[model samples]
Target: MIVMSVVGVTALAVGGGALLMTDNNASAAKETPAQQAAARAGMTVKCPDVATSLSNVPQQARPAVNNELAKMDSQVADAYQRLAEPGAKADQESVRTRVLDPLTSERRQTLDRIATEIEKVQPRPSGLDSLAACTVKQDQAAAADAQAAAPNTPAAGNTAPAAGAQGTGGQGTGAQGTGGQQQSGPQRADFVDIRKVKPNVKNPRVQGKGSKGTFSSRCGRNENKHFNSDNVIVAPGVSNGAHHMHDYVGNKKTDAFASNQVLESAGTTCTNGDRSTHYWPVLRLQDGTKEFDAGAPGGGTEGNVGRILRPTSVQLSFKGNPVSKVVEMPKFLRIITGDAKAFTNGTANANASWSCTGFENRQLKDKYPLCPKGSNVVRTFKFQSCWDGKNIDSANHRTHVAFARADGSCQQGFKAIPQLVQRITYKLAPGARNFAVDSFPEQLHKPVTDHGDFINVMSQKLMKQAVSCINSGRKCG
Candidate 1:
């Protein structure tokens, strides 16, 4: 019996030891698979969700990194070329639109959201589980306790008293509640298309009268007075039919000295629709008038444009002031193309005619010598001294300009067109009025100014002159 008991006890003890060994092996088995995989695959045991935690980095720093990456791929050459171009305004707009503005707005919104999320983690002591989970029981109990409390009962440290509590107005729960009311929105703009306006068939009346023959007030005058031959009434400040007034009424003679002849023939009417009339301070408007006053008394026939007295009864008004006596004189003659070297020395044929717009000319006389002498038309005064901005001779500046003449020939030199007559002078005699004229100013239309090569030549000359003057201790100016 004793021998049997010892053997049984030894067997029980051996079985218990084996069970303890199995428990230790089971714990090792739990960690072995992960450790083996990490070692075999050369992988790490870091958190799989690491991106989510690191994404919590301040949003502001993210854009800076993105901008840096964009710059690495940017076209540096194209940017420099654009910057080097003339009138290259700084492009700060790109920085604001592409980077700063969007980054600032998004960062503000993200910061607000982060603050709200932080508030979600209950206001607990530091080191407490920031990610702690909460069940419904705690919330429910707190709600129930709050409801069961007396109505209007002031909570601790509250300014306003509770509705049914003992506290008066002094301690009442400060309920001047500015509740979560959204801010009032701004008023939106109303948009409409202005192109919907109907075209008015009847012309607008002239309301303003400017100077002599110039109707400054366009609001009240007749529509016919303002309308051109094409029935198009030009708006104020536009270069239209009225602007050609002087061109239309230029000197009535081709020969400057001939009383019967015009500075050039009134070849054609651009618009044959209607003949415009002007209110003059001279003799009556007659079919056949002769022997008119020359107006100029002395000064060597410089201003003596031939005139004819009218047989019909006449009235006169000068500069808008009514004059008692009337003497009809032919309009001022415009010298359209004459010599840049010599103006009056220009050749004349029976059909000779010239064309230049925005040119001015004064007849050569002993007092005001024709261009290049003491005349306003001359610019080459002291050869080198004519470079002064103050000494600009605007008349002769158009001298070298080339323009098509009424005879279809090219003419050179300075020429003037009577402002009223220019409208009709350039057209073929048979059809002046209907002709469509280019409205380009003389400067834009003619190649008068030597721009490219001339600039370099003049610059080099000036530089040499400047150095010479400096070395000689003399003033270049």
Candidate 2:
């Protein structure tokens, strides 16, 4: 009867202990994964004076402690694996709270104290392997603890993109940021460079008055008779009742008010093309003394300032084929000489006058060369500046340092200029003043006398200087 009573009391005690344990775990199980993880991270394992307490612990307690420790090991391993697995962070956090949180506050503290006592009882090991192992465990524990404490904290919530993100767009945020840079690209028009052909005033073919002449030669027309060439052809409108071809210049005839550079002909596209002339620009050297060398010509405009400014040549058109022709300067293509004062001071050019059919009074429309029976005509001219000392004052005559051809016609007769056209005004030599008349011998050119003997003496002196230079130096010009 006494034995039964003892057994009943022991059973009641065991039931109460189990109920207490269940009560302790109920709160932990109910907690969310994130809450549990946060609680475990915040819990501290206070290392106590475990060595003193362990002396009084019963030998039977060792089994319970070892069992608890083994369970902790498995739980830690499982938690680590889950945390490492793809997309299992939330689940792993939950497991840590269920298993690790309870131990962190009590069991872990007791275990840490016990470990300290054990270490005190035994000296350090001879082999460093244990130390290394312990170090690794400590590092892992620290990392795990940190993760649990701040599970939901953002790594870079407020910072800008990292430096490495420049090239990579999305996966690496820093790289993506870098890849969004805007780049400047060149424009299409910038890549295409066009060089316009300058007009020439030294030629004769593009000048003179028009004439009432019939088609005398088959040079400009073909059997099929089509205006396929580059010449500007003009003729009276054909009597095609259905096709009303408006004349190019319309009713505007060749008037003095029109530009001298090109004839003011009909504006309409002429079906029976007749009058056509093509011209090119002429280039002159910078210095007034250089002679024309065809091998190299100048880069800018070219012209002469004699009795009349004339067109030297024209691109002829037969039927549609271009024919090379020569013509004198027309009355319209005259060049006006600038004043000597302006030349000395390097002033802008004067507003010169020009007439397509001679000055305002003597209109030369009747003298205009008539087009072929079925053709019309077009006219164009070019302005040019010249500096030959023949007629110009020595002070006004610029040194011819280079020469060039616009139509490629004078290329054979002139040397090429080294400078660009825009750079011309800046490169002129300063102080080109005229010399006294007493310095020249008689019988120089009549044109130079008209201007003054200033150029003659200067030219002579320059020629002598060049000769002396050539004698002294083998490479001198």
Candidate 3:
């Protein structure tokens, strides 16, 4: 199941055309423990992920199908917003009638259009309509249960030592916002103290034939503030396809409409002339200050309200496979690691790893870490290290690349390639818990929804240099 968002359409209405209003604060204050527990259990829209179901879509039909997919995302987002409205949950029957039913109809139509487009050039995908229906289900119980089941004992593994004494937390007034917290998320269960997590990271042993070198690109920490809600990799040409703001580095012109030519000609932040684009959802302090996009499509209006936190450090490094020599990635190769809609879509594709600078050995896939007084929050992404050897892109944007197995080996037909490891650190006040990553309105800003997007725009010569340095077992920049 997955969901998406946009502006304006109110999916739920009280009496004909009237908006339902309630004093949530007042009513919450009077609830008993049992009632409060029930209240914390929020609901979200869950629909089958249509994009992942298709493969081998004709290039001519891709634009239309992608547009339809974006529309489906918007439909989910709009429906989720309506579900989050005050008093909407109190009337489940009304919600099902007004919101879910209409959303299903809209999605069905969009799915049909997508199939029609694909049929124009290729055989129509079967059963797309079956993916249209969505359901509203409680969102918090599963996460809470998973948290409770997490191991408490330390596991045998190597851990990255804390970098150094923590720097001051991010620059902000640390003020609480008047806009209030996101209606559905970042529950107490969503955060865990780093001290409580066991060291669970275990690296595969490097074989004798391994390419043991590393190549790093010095891309600035997005100091110029390249931000947008468009995703050129998955939803090219669709504005606000992401439904959340992303912080970008490297490529200067990377909106949804930017073609490969535009990206190649664009100025870059990388010192090595690597025009590759690296981006991820911006983390925001839940302090109620209105950001520049507060009322815009992908910000406050879409249920993402907070002060954006700039990363204290962004490290982009390409490392070699531990089992075999690596191949140079094709120019314009795009890779998306982690699922942006993992909250409702499930963790099958969720690859987000959260940890504290000092406790990098203990990675968290679902919960955000509360670092010690001197430790900073860290988000690390170790992208796919194998490619299908032919396609630079895929119908689902993931099939072209894949992660290596536990022994650091690529699958039967896939070729091992340089693995991009992105590590971003953020300094936050000790014990701070009011922080979350930007996400689709319906995703409820869950930590599991954290994801990273990358496009390899390096020139052929530069890529050759990187591969040569890696295969020769030398670290280069």
Candidate 4:
């Protein structure tokens, strides 16, 4: 076997044998039982070779672009190597900072560079294009590799798992592309296939003339990484903060231990007489500023990290039951939508709705549309108001509260409560560019972790008034 240095890494014989990777401080450490027992499966992490594809690029751009890709690939390999090492951080915090965040950033930077370089090519490639064509190639290869893992694929907690290894320790869950089945864990299942996610809402039960109303909240940019308050709702105030921070809208004070009593007494950012407790992750500006998001370095959430998409409109409305009667929502009812556990492993369960002030027709994904002068970036959220006569909260963070099926009828055993819809808009001064949503560092700004939480804390009078708005079909401000 012969050796040569290519871009600081060595090349070895063309056979499947021990590959020697040398570094100034390299040492050969023997394997330990703990390390061997970590992962249920294994995978190879390396940058895809773009040399063969470079032949299609102009000679002038080939060398420069190839170098750029090589750098990206090297970064990926290094990340994988570190993640695979024995005793790597298997916990959620460690995985995000050590694996997800760095990898997400690296992937983002690489794709951005590839996009820049691809623009320089005389004959641009078409189809399978976003940032760089290589992304798709790499993902496809990864998917194949994941599918080929043996023995149930071991939940990716070990095996240097990037196969959606955002902490699928016991479930045998692999990452999305790795063909892993993520069940609302660190990585959520995919966004239910964009095709199935049709924008055309069905059954159109948006009834009642005055039930329509609007309200706004400036949840602020995600200033701190404490938004959702991990495991707080079920257990009053344990951590008392989320892996990220949130902008409080309706409630004047919302914290980890906030109770239904406190929320009712709290003031709201909205001027409308309605006083429901509404909150969501804050929106952020893209200025290269780093914070400790769940997926970001110094992040703290177990199931954290992902793109924080700019919301187009935070539309608000009310819903009623089959009887068309306005019923006050039970006090202390807590409802949460969207998965916070959505990390970059393609387990994002996102139904993010984004749009422009005037360009309402243009709903976008992955990329936030740049608003023209004077227009605002909008974000909207609708909550499920109908509740099962039994539980206020569920183990999955959902299901206890149910959404009205297309017919405007609550399923059997569920009672309809006055549900409020919120839509917010952000006017980014004038000529705003490079604006990004606040997200877990590992989200890589992919716009998937968008979610909302609400607690029914309205006073009896306020609750009735709000419910009347929907039942009477009157729009309240």
Candidate 5:
């Protein structure tokens, strides 16, 4: 799959579908073996994303609302575990009775509480009750495999080429199947050779008033081993909110419970004295070696296993806007660039870009690139650059920031701010393809679910310096 920069315009590609079923005896006779296999694969829970509907949460109600939202995520995760258990898929009626029904009840109660909390401060939000129900769908990995096996058909996930296509630099098989680990995915269909992909990356057009400079932050490759499964920006005060381990860099004090005041007073890993927090899901090799979090809630217990692989290089750079001078990012401005639930939520918000060190021009959004010998796997995130001038965040954590248009201009009423580009590279063993990133169990370690998080805690002086450097067309660190 070719992934363009977040600021550039790309056509929306929808893949995957609900479970396929034949209605009559005539249709059943024509069903292929791949179709039968897909029909027998395990099911997953799909729920409406309540957070996305919240556009005007009052300030006093945010904490309560946020906690409720986090609770809904936990509810889904728990339901998924039940769905994956032995005998859980014995039959459709059994699954509905044992898992789906209970989950719907829990979600309904939680949604009610969230509505009550909001009503205490403002008018109650309508339609939340409608989001309470969840449904079972065919496992996406199985669906992709079935699609890949069909003649003249592309996989029903991301835009990677058909399976076993020639000229892909490395072995066509996936790396995650090693050590007999019971991972749900990183299936063979999820990888493609980097050499086969066309160069599809394009930058926004830089106009006459564009800020042409760049500012880089010298943060080490997580040498201190700051890893956790907490998300302070999205689920503050809630432990294990992320449900997958994260590799953190920049701010030394970051977790679900860290307040803005705590962050302001905390130390930093950035050599430039920037205290901003940056983090993303940790990548792991499926070599069967157990890490410290093994058996823990966010690690083995949550289906994220294997030895964590440290990145060889992590580059955090802030670049100028393409169409106008840049303004300083507000302190505590939080941005989440990619969708961590892309496997189930679809790819409308998925922004993960995977490539190889030498093949940087060819980016893959849905498939993990198979790098040839001597090449390292690379993950890059280009964050949104247009900020709503008044708020540091929004109810959904995304509305406060927007990506610039294809021409690199901010929408009316939005201001152009420095765009953050996070690039991390990992050196894997030659021909090794058994690596996967940590993710929610239902996400199945898919590359499309890879995401990054950022919170700007830069000092006022540093923020001003970055703005000045960008507007002046100078490269500064």
Candidate 6:
């Protein structure tokens, strides 16, 4: 009858999985009726005040902290959502293995990072105290989830478990009757939603290293003097003024108000003749010198303006809506990647898009970190490609395009298209070489504002070709 028991064998860890099912089941056999009742009815806890404590963090480190927090909250929230799945309640072990375990590890690292930054600036541990409390509450809930996932079994005695034991894999309790409810409403996300949350494990419908539809342009580059916002189109031809400055690549005639007609006719940066105008914020040196712009997108120049060049390759592929192929994307849709508003408006990083010497093995943070000598500094981008099947643009220019779930599936109601991930690299070997992306002066050369903007100007002919390549499962470059 005993359902829950306080693990007595190990030190209660915050994020790491606490105890094994063997330990719990071994003890559960002896639990009295009272213990079972308490176990069925999980403990009560209070929510942590994350914002008020974040105020104490250094202004410079706030974005990184905020970004990390969003990720953590998202981690837990995804688990809760899955907990509502059909089998989630029965197999707590499977749920813990796939979801909770990873969630705890990520939370641990995030808390440690927040703590480190807190110590760097302020003496009072306000942020740490609050975040720590939040983790503790989450940990308690996760433990209950694990316990609930464990099957009620008789004591197996004091027999020791083998090394690297993966646990009983039995049917136990889950987040259903244990983990507390978040909020009331159909729109409520079990976790925080600064942006949409992708699934934990993405099972690609079409999987491979080469299945892609690509368009290349050798058009020259253009580096504006400052961070330029192409908000003019969204703002109705405001002329050279938007959110921040941007460096346009591909199509020649690119301004906030430039239409598809203008873009199609403009000369392209692509030597191969693709006239697509691709652009992102410019990267400038911290010193604000002309030399740093050496490798930048040369507005009137061709081939590796200063330092920028047509990315070695521009890859496009379509991802199914978490399960099936995507339909055609409406023309003239405005898809914005990364956070431009964050750099200027003092809001949380929208995309928190980052870069590193090696995109696979990440190390940099909110800003672009200076890579060591003899390294290929890579600029990475993850665009919002999934469509809501309706609006081309939202009030924030983001809500319209849904993000892929943890498993790389488009959120419900969103049709998945090619989640275009443009990873560009620069050959800047170690030393005092000149290379940096233009960022807010306070941003300190970090790659936070490194967002991308693309207008779908593909004529019906070209669009049809792209659709064929994707739907037919061919790699067209």
Give the distance in Å from residue 40's predicted Cα in candidate 6 to where it truly belongs: 56
lDDT of 5 by residue, 76-156 (tens): 888877765532222445556877689989988998998899889877766666766676555545545534444433233
Candidate 4 CA-lDDT value: 0.44
For candidate 1, give the lDDT: 0.18
Q: Count clashes in each candidate, considering only residues at least 3 apart in sequence or on different chains.
A: 60, 84, 4, 41, 3, 50
Per-residue CA lDDT of model 4 for 75-117, tens digit only, reads 5445544544444433334544665467656655665565466
Which candidate ranks first by lDDT, i.e. highest? 5
List candidate 5 stretches off by more than 4 Å.
Answer: 1-42, 143-182
Greater-TM-score candidate between 2 and 5: 5
Clashes of 1: 60
Each model's Cα RMSD: 42.2, 44.8, 9.7, 20.8, 7.0, 20.6
Judge candidate 1 at residue 404 and give its lDDT. 31
Shift of residue 266 alpha carbon in model 3, Å:
0.1
For each candidate in turn, the TM-score is: 0.13, 0.13, 0.85, 0.51, 0.86, 0.47
Q: Please, what is the whole-model Cα lDDT of each candidate in the order they appear?
A: 0.18, 0.20, 0.76, 0.44, 0.76, 0.41
Tens-place lDDT per residue, model 2, 1-477, is 000112222232223112111123455455454433333221111111111122222333333433333333333323322322222222223434543344334444445543443344343212111111000001112223333344542122111011111111111101111112111100111111111212223422321221111111111111122211011111011111101011111112222122323343432112222222221111111122222221111100011101111222122211100112212212222222221112111123221111121122211111111222222121222123222212221111222211224332223332221111110001111211110000000100111111100101112343343333322322221
**Can you write out model 6's per-residue Cα lDDT over 266-361, one digit (the tens) per residue?**
766555455655667554322222233233222110011122332333333333333445567676777777654233223343564433343334
What is candidate 3's CA lDDT for residue 253?
100
Question: Which residue pairs in candidate 3 have backbone atoms (N, alpha carbon, C) closer than 3 angstroms, thus clashing?
Answer: 4-77, 5-77, 162-358, 177-288
lDDT by residue (tens digit), candidate 1, 123-207: 3112112111110001111112222333332222121111111112111111111121010000010111112222322312322
Question: Could you say which candidate leads in TM-score?
Answer: 5
Badly placed stretches (over 4 Å) of model 3 are 1-41, 141-183
Q: Is candidate 3 or candidate 5 better by TM-score?
A: 5
